[model samples]
Target: MPLLFLRRCGWLGLLACLLTACGSHQKAPPAFTASGYVADRGAMRLWRKDDVAQQTVNIVSVYSPYKGENTVITRYQFIRDDVRQINRTQNGEHPETLQIRFDDKGNPSFMQRQRDGLREKLSDDELALYQFEARRLLDVSQSLRAGQVILMQGRWRNGVMTTCDGNEVDPDFDRRSASWVAARTQRSTGQLGVAWLEAPEGTQLLLVANEDFCHWQPKKSEL
Candidate 1:
């Protein structure tokens, strides 16, 4: 009896060791791609409604402050690949929105919005969407104009970054209602909206960022 019990304990320890090793081998997610578009450049044009007036604005790009200020009225695009989309709307105004699309294999497809539509941004060989969006944002913010394409580059310290500030928590955790309620406390905060585009069989998901717009840490359900 003693010998049998000792053998069982040894087997259990080996199983635990194997499980832990497998868990450690799990891979982390790829870093986000970023780029900025030049809104003032001659090649690209900002979308303006016919009813809007055509004023002679400054040649320099104007960026809306993340806090305590009105909209900067610049045109910038923030895009992730096949993972999410973040659209902004405020006081009846429709701000720019981001979109992401994925391929059948569950890998992301680099796509871009052209002629007011989305097309693959990168070929299968070149998969770099985050870098493209980051650069586009920087260019637009740096030299914003009425008619130009600008994209911005940002990093996700924990989860992701959106145009709005003060909302840093990951906007992806919808199941945690308690956390969502706490995030709304900061009325001035802006959260990121996520949409997964699985092309041909695409799935659209909307993720709301926390009040800080920096971290994407989802709270525990019980908490």
Candidate 2:
């Protein structure tokens, strides 16, 4: 039968040259995820790991609920997981401490922080959600190829409190400032935080997020 059709076309030409030499021996890099607001070198300052021991840092800065004068700073850190390591660098400028470890299926398996050159201030949609989470961690480098998710939607500003002059007051839990002028005549919705970083770029992820709001009592401001 024509020598079995030439041995089935020589086994389909050796399976297309071994699938083109395994797609040129694979290649791709650059990635990140652990959801926004991160700074590490073993914890130089700024972190957000969702949970493990809880964390929140951004030490100081006051005002700007809506640019009453443009001032915002209040930093702090300590994350639960999302692997980070860079530990030790106290005063070249900022970030002076950090240490973390977590993985074994909990994700962010190891971390360390510190890199004294503090420079944190991101907004413009948090730098387009950190360049779409470093391009979705370079398109899911691996975890078998996919497995890392983080999504956040806005319109929340509950109870406000972080003063020592760093602004954002509502001490009574919120409700004053001339009755918050009927909460600016009601229905405002403005204050956002969005994230979607995937993680991959020498793994050392972090994301310690925090939010609080619940003090809106306005129903009487008819011009």
Predicted model with the maximum lDDT: 1
Candidate 2 lDDT tens digits, 1-223: 1111212323233233333333343443112212221221111111222222343111111112231222222222223322222222233323344333333343334443434544444345643443343233222222212222221212224433332224453322123332443353244454322111222221221211122111211111200
Q: For model 2, what is the C-alpha lDDT against the true structure?
A: 0.26
TM-score of each: 0.17, 0.17
CA error at residue 51 for candidate 2, angstroms: 26
Q: Per-residue alpha-carbon lDDT of model 1 for 108-149, expressed as tens digits?
A: 554443223333344544335443543443333222221111
* Per-residue lDDT value at 127 in model 2: 38
Candidate 2 wrongly placed segments (more than 4 Å):
1-30, 34-84, 88-96, 99-145, 157-223
Model 1 earns a TM-score of: 0.17
In order, the Cα lDDT scores of the candidates are 0.28, 0.26
Q: Model 1 residue 102 lDDT?
A: 45
